[model samples]
Target: MVNYASGEAKGELSGAEYRRYSRHLLLPGFTPESQRKLRSAKVAVVGAGGLGSPILQYLAAAGVGSLTVIDADLVDSSNLQRQVIHSEAAVGTPKVASAAHAVHALNQAVHVREVPEVLTPANALATLAGHDLVLDGTDNFPTRYLVSDACEILNVPLIWGSILAFDGQVAVFFGDEGRGVTYRDVHPRPPEPGEVPSCSEAGVLGPLVGVIGSTMAMEALKVLTGLGSPLYGRIQLYSALTGDWTRLDVARRAGRAPVTEIEDLVETCGFPAVEASGAAPVRAEVLSPAEALREAATGRLLIDIREESEAAEGMLPHAVNIPKTQLMEFARGERAGVGPLSEVGDLHGAILHCAGGARSAAAQAELAALGISVANMAGGYVASVTLRP
Candidate 1:
């Protein structure tokens, strides 16, 4: 929804404005005035992982005045495949700071702010307020809802993206846009209690994130500059396996609870339904590949939570190699209805492994959150190799 204020005021801009945004101004039908508007646009993105990588990269490349990134994670070696915003040197650095610096590297003219904290209700308002757009690259439901409800209350647009195994969704929620729909419009209730798996729980395809994230950035551009058709009130799905694309036009839910604040959203959605926040953490059990081999023989599930490509290199003899990106969707597919108990079925036992211990541990914990019981292979895939001569 274009909300250009009427009457009139398209004044001449400054020299730096012309110089800083000269390229954009040079485009046909995109005058210096439009460049200035883009140069003045500010956006805040939650989470700096898979989707956030390309989202931030493109926004900075476009010179979107200011970019603020909020994330409490640290870059891991495993993330190198997908979370492209960070590099080898940034492996141990804070994600927000690392991502901010990465954006600055792309365009020094753009101001970057790093909020190195988990987005919570208290700071949700401050984090979102004053920004022209908020991007949701967050991984979990609790945080996703936090950003969504905050945008809804502030009456701003939220550019959202989600990647599950191989399928992904992109949509723009504009509580302020004309009778627009919010996140609730698409999937009213969170996935079945045990059905939604997370990024760490399942792995993601590195470039796949770029595909969805860059598109989200483009959507942000459309919403910010009124340049093209917005994704608001619309949903786009991309599938890697089939290389198919689908778009769904959506509308608001009938008689849904009015969303005023993040808290109301928490209550309305019955989120934190099982209290993942305060629940005691689960312990991940790790094992050597030899140890894993022994366990797999007992009809146990060996889940490889690495990215799709990485898993293809090689996995345990009987491992079920569902990449992280497909985890959430996998849980909801027929597998959950017929697979092992620890996974789709009520399996008696399971083992989780990743390239490194961190990703596997993360995957283990995320699945455990969905009530999956499994042991984490401590040393990860590298620990599984046979000794060479």
Candidate 2:
């Protein structure tokens, strides 16, 4: 026998809360009772970037009792486009700190626990346990699988969302192995490494993330307040170009094994094995950005391994624009006629760079496998520009 009408789950709201959530309190179906449910809810949000930005903002504003923000990444200038919780001054700050600051500003009554560490298989369960629900905003596959698995073991609902380019998808998974669907029901296996391009590689529209993130927050509110049917067995897809939304139903796979415990997700997802059994570690020759610039100035070959559009923004004056795709093709000896690599003879001792250092590092590995010695510019173009002064 629970009395919800008085809105006293944790305790009665203060006069300030009544004013702050007055609109919600006035809704016909939703009374202050629902607001109390929201006030008693505890949510864990993974990845305090893009989708996490909106999810955290709205939930804190809606007065979620507590939020655990988990992320290891630091704020960068690029994130400001859609990670609206952070400011220009917050760049180089840990994302969780910036996100917690924003949450406090929005609602001081909401408690925030900022864990500035990457969620790994070793700690996923410990980090995510005890929360009423988990919202996933991470951009990669392995972490997604890890979070979903951890939720399954914890028997918590997962509010999941993803955005790439102009396309976004949102879904709710209850992670109850037999009764309802989980992320594994939707994506039984993770995509192979390199099969899917990251937002950094493919580029994403900033506003698209806001739409998906806000939708995710709305879904979380519904689940927390028991207001309406949640998207437990459905996935919603949005196309900004077409301005249409489509919903598809998903179900738990029959006889799908329950997730008993978390395992090494990186290995399970088939990411490149970090160190093979007893094999010598292969390290690429690295060059400081300053040294790479000097080499480029002296007319040494410098290959910009980013895509054509990225190179057009600003590239080293003497750098050749051989995109990562073309470079990989050349590494595989599948050179096309009139390929960009053909414009420069002998890539044996060239330097490679990208907007950041990741693409260049991947490209360097591919070239190294073909016995082509190339030096990767540490920190890539970003560091190069910083060192210019």
Candidate 3:
């Protein structure tokens, strides 16, 4: 039998640690044995933005022995609204570096390893190889799909979360290894281009992120130490304004593969055309980065998904504050902070940008789910700025 306990049942924690996690040790399901399992387990979190911030902090504070955090971007002013791991002082630092510092600050006993580079398909399998369970805190579809496929290949469970304006969703995918499904099993396709709005195109509720991200942290703990029933294969959805949380059941397909577009995304992760089982994709009206800069009134919502600090560093004149990590949930649940949002508002075209293309393109697909037509800024925010500069 695979022991959830790490064979250190009797004297796992010292007096200080026992006091710190006294309540946990006393919980019906969480004994010293389970706590030892937590100390033995290692978790890898793929992003350190809105969702990642809560996942990392709580896991560290709760004493997950070691954590591996990977993120290629930098901290910016825009990130301050939802990404809690970073402070205003750390705005300019790389996300992984700042996040690692924050984790260590919370609990030096918990180890945090920072991978400043973005997780790509090439390195994903190796990156996720050793962790007991990997947390899905990535911001975009390509990365999400990449992580899901990699986890499935590695036989690891993924604790996933996504957030937008006022709503978010969390679930445990591939938790049972031989039986469960992946992110692909749930959404299937990335979506047609220009179908959704990037956070920059729309605004988000700051605290909404905290609610979902912290829940992701909670889910990770449940899966790691065998504390309770995991949210395996079922998505827990949340809405802040109504404070309604709903659960969507997910089960593996009997025999056929769950996703149809799996073969197409194996190459670049971008699909100009995508068709999935769930819903029709929204179409986006757009200008290439070149055209948008020259004309400036393409009518496309130009979204800058970089952190706020990065935005202060500079941004497109009409850009907004939704980060890419929040893209999927935002597209589904967001309301404009300064104006009324309607079904038509969800269908508007947009140009999504990040420091580069990675996050923006991913955000574009999630918006497609919300009925917006979207496209990625070709060279990304850097390219957009360079063209207009």
Candidate 4:
């Protein structure tokens, strides 16, 4: 076992490590011993986009003994805006590979493990085990819950951070059974599917993730080296627009049961229904991008279900902007005169799209529930524009 108290361990730092970490060695609270503890620590960072970028950079720079970066995504041009660990040249490369490159560039003394697979409930334990702590920078709710549940089961601390738009949140969950609070205590139930737009949909400021990711890295160091009262049992909220920071105390729910095992998070989280085989069967009526463009050229209404901010980036020309949320409300007839639905006169046979196909698919389901049939643009705007014929 690594001794965090004195930072000295079987994996003692070399002369180069000493010189490289001289500043950390000199900090009053973070002594040379703490630096050694960092050198002996092993951490797993989930997700290599946005928040994960800074968390990985700082942790590797801090000389954490080993870092296992897990992410299934490939870097996209859009990711360069905030996912700073990846470079322009790395745009089509696996995010975990790009992250490993960045980590090694920062500190060759630290070991890097790249896992280019998605973290699913089935593989959560195996993927997250052996790490002293887990840092969660995942953007979706299901993965967040999975990380928390896995940490709870493994009896490890989770350094969690989330950022959307100008707002960000950080928290630390630790301890077992009666003592510590898990993420469920903070949010007993996941938000309704599509209730909140992801960073991809709503868009986030580039600097906003940097601020939150750095904060998460700081908390991770605190947890690993016992530097201070790690944000365990507390939630920190930051709003870049207002330049304000607030902390809230979180306690384990009085009667809430502890998470004993992981569950089917997709079903539990109320995600849209899919085929039992875990693949969404292609709906024959779904229009190909070329077909949609042809229809649009003939004055067919193409509704962009992405958030207005997402649409502003660039959307299918001639598509009307009716955000998914407003479109759902309009489909329910709960909000009249709120979207292009009013202009559609009849909701039947409307065409819808989002950044990707998911939201548009959900919108299609919503309108279908209201007895309206809409053709979803396959692959949404991305494919529509990229595959323009």
Top candidate by lDDT = 2
For model 4, residues 1-389, the per-residue Cα lDDT tens digits are 11112233456667877788898988889877788788888899999999999999999888787888899777877788899999989977888888888887777767788889989989999999999999999988889999999998899999999999899999999857547998888988887545676675677999999999999999989988998788988999999999999999999989876677887676534244433133453332477778988888898888887777877887777888888888777767678876545643566677878875657766765655555667877556765544443
TM-score of 2: 0.79
What TM-score goes with each of the models?
0.67, 0.79, 0.70, 0.79
Candidate 3 positional error at 346, Å = 30
Whole-model lDDT, candidate 4?
A: 0.80
Q: Model 4 misses residue 286 by how many Å? A: 12
lDDT of each: 0.72, 0.81, 0.71, 0.80
- lDDT (Cα) of model 1: 0.72
Please, what are the lDDT tens digits per residue for candidate 1 over residues 208-291?
898899989999988888886898778999998888889998989887765875663432221222213357653345566677
* lDDT digits (tens) for residues 1-389 of candidate 3: 01122222234577777888888887887887777778777899989988889889999888788788888777877789888889999867788888888877777777677788867767887878899999987656677888887888788889888876677889999735556778877876675333444454445688877898889889888888877888987999998889999989987766644332223252334444432236663333334577655434645466677767777877776666566555554456644332222444643555667765556655665555555666666546654533453
Please give the lDDT score for candidate 3: 0.71
Where in model 4 is the C-alpha error above 4 Å? 1-11, 268-270, 274-304, 307-352, 356-365, 371-389
RMSD of 3: 10.0
